[model samples]
Target: MFKYAWICKNPDLKGMARRAILQAMDTKPYSTWLEIDLGAIKNNIKQLKAMTGTRLMAVIKANAYGHGVLTVAKAAEQAGASWLGVARMEEALNLRAAGIKSEVMVLGYTSPVM
Candidate 1:
């Protein structure tokens, strides 16, 4: 079983929480972190769902393409996504580790022998 090592941080204080830590500006020190706007994502998903009138599958991988996976998955789940797609077993396991109960598929494939 793979373990989830990523930590979700409050971006406001730390600045955009990314792979590399960004120092807060000294001149105009404020919340430099880019906060995840989950509500907006949810709204967008809702709009898409209404527009398409079909099921929506959220493809989240590569740590949500550097957008943070766990938080994005949680937001996608809340946004009425019926399915979630990842890139590898570890990524799928990470979503499960994060308490996401939605359907998740790993699109990344490896060699049979690996």
Candidate 2:
């Protein structure tokens, strides 16, 4: 089990992120869980963008390293990610199905027959 609190400097963003985490916990009680601070993810993306002075491609493969792909992807996009990277076409499709409009790239090999 993991627990965390929203510590973003932006008050509005902090509130939204905190609510999202709390909602997730509420929906999945009594199960092993990892509490991801979405606010931290957003802040890190923003910082990286500032440091690089270029657009960023957020790699959200493997359920965002087990942090919930959809949630992390949305937060990254909101924080100015220009693209999303995944390991498979199915992951990309799942993102699209969830209404993620960010440009996506499948980094893994695909069978020609598919």
Report every candidate's CA lDDT: 0.80, 0.93
What clash pairs does model 1 have? 15-33, 16-33
With candidate 2 superimposed using the best TM-score fit, by how many Å does residue 65's alpha carbon deviate from the native? Answer: 1.3
In TM-score terms, candidate 2 sits at: 0.69
Q: RMSD, model 1, all Cα superposed?
A: 12.1
Index of the highest-lDDT prediction: 2
lDDT for each residue of candidate 1 in 73-95, tens digit (9 for 90 to 100): 98999989999999888888878
TM-score of each: 0.65, 0.69
Which ranges of candidate 2 are over 4 A from the true structure? 1-33
Model 1 stretches astray by more than 4 angstroms: 1-33, 110-114
**lDDT of model 2 at residue 21?**
79
After TM-score superposition, the amount by which residue 63's alpha carbon in candidate 2 deviates from its true location, in angstroms, is 0.9
